[model samples]
Target: MRLCVEVFNGYRPPAHLRRLARPADAAEVVAQGLVGARRIAELRRPRRPGDRRPKHTTPVAVRRVYLCEPRSGAVEVAVALVTGERTWAMALRLELHQDTWCATTLRLI
Candidate 1:
């Protein structure tokens, strides 16, 4: 599948799992090494009435990791939002690993 479609579908292959050098790999290398503070805030915010806010609002970091197969033209990535705590936030990043690198599409689910 094309990188754009795979990312949307969130289908990741097994081999791509090993390439997860670190939680931040995709964020730094692929996602332009940048973190969207507003985006994080939106995700961390309480969506429902029963949802409780964190005791403290801490700044979390974003990282992206990927799995790719050249022959099959498939790529899968995981975007991790790391915080001081062990249980941070994370999103699935899927793409096509091509000769020309581009993060054309993303899904934060």
Candidate 2:
């Protein structure tokens, strides 16, 4: 979950995290999201002194986490800011693989 916040806010993710998604999904996210996160290649400049909001002014935090299947090792996580124009929620899906939990999918809105 921490990795998700960092990735969305312009930080490099760990190698294993890069493989969290299927190849196609990872490719699309990297091409469309991570690249810009690194450099803001398409970010628009502010038109007035206070037109643009500072990046991540509010704190980012993990709101809640749950074990979807407690006895079986399926986990669900939710993270979002306490205050914002809208809820910036991120959901994660993880399953135990070979005795180790591995994230398989991520959704944000």
Candidate 3:
């Protein structure tokens, strides 16, 4: 989903998603960690010089997203990421808290 992409792209929650300018949910995921900033950097790294890889490597793309609502206030999301020729899978769990959705967990599948 766009929200997932936006969060991962910057490795931080968007302003609108923050509460009192504090994004505790996303901060938790980035801190105790899933898809840390280091990981994102690694994924976006360009092929090294003279590596014989294709010149036009594709940017990271969201290939697929599967959402599941197992309960009224919880959501589970499975996402597939495509970068160049490889694909990676990630999962995120969210819950509605105080009328706002908060990320409880995020990890690679």
Highest lDDT: give the candidate number.
Answer: 3
The TM-scores, one per candidate, come to 0.33, 0.56, 0.63
Tell how far residue 88 is off in model 3, in angstroms: 0.9
- For each candidate, the alpha-carbon lDDT, in order, equals 0.41, 0.53, 0.62
Q: Which candidate would rank higher by lDDT, 1 or 3? A: 3
Candidate 1 local lDDT, 44-95, one digit each (tens): 6788999998887654445444455444544545555454453333334334
Off by over 4 Å in 3: 1-3, 6-26, 32-36, 43-57
C-alpha lDDT of residue 68 in model 2: 57
Put down candidate 2 lDDT per residue, 1-109, tens digits, no spaces: 6666565555555343566655545554444335433333123335477797566444344565544554567777665633233345655667777676666666664
- The candidate with the higher lDDT, 1 or 2, is 2
Q: What overall lDDT, based on C-alpha atoms, would model 2 receive against the true structure?
A: 0.53
Task: Arrange candidates by TM-score, descending.
Answer: 3, 2, 1
Which of the two, 1 or 2, has more TM-score?
Answer: 2
Extract clashing residue pairs from model 2: none
Q: Tell me the lDDT of model 2 at 85.
A: 39
Per-residue lDDT of candidate 3, residues 1-109 (tens digit): 4554555566354443333212656565654333433465565565686556445545557898899999999999998987667676777788888887777776654
Whole-model alpha-carbon lDDT for candidate 3: 0.62
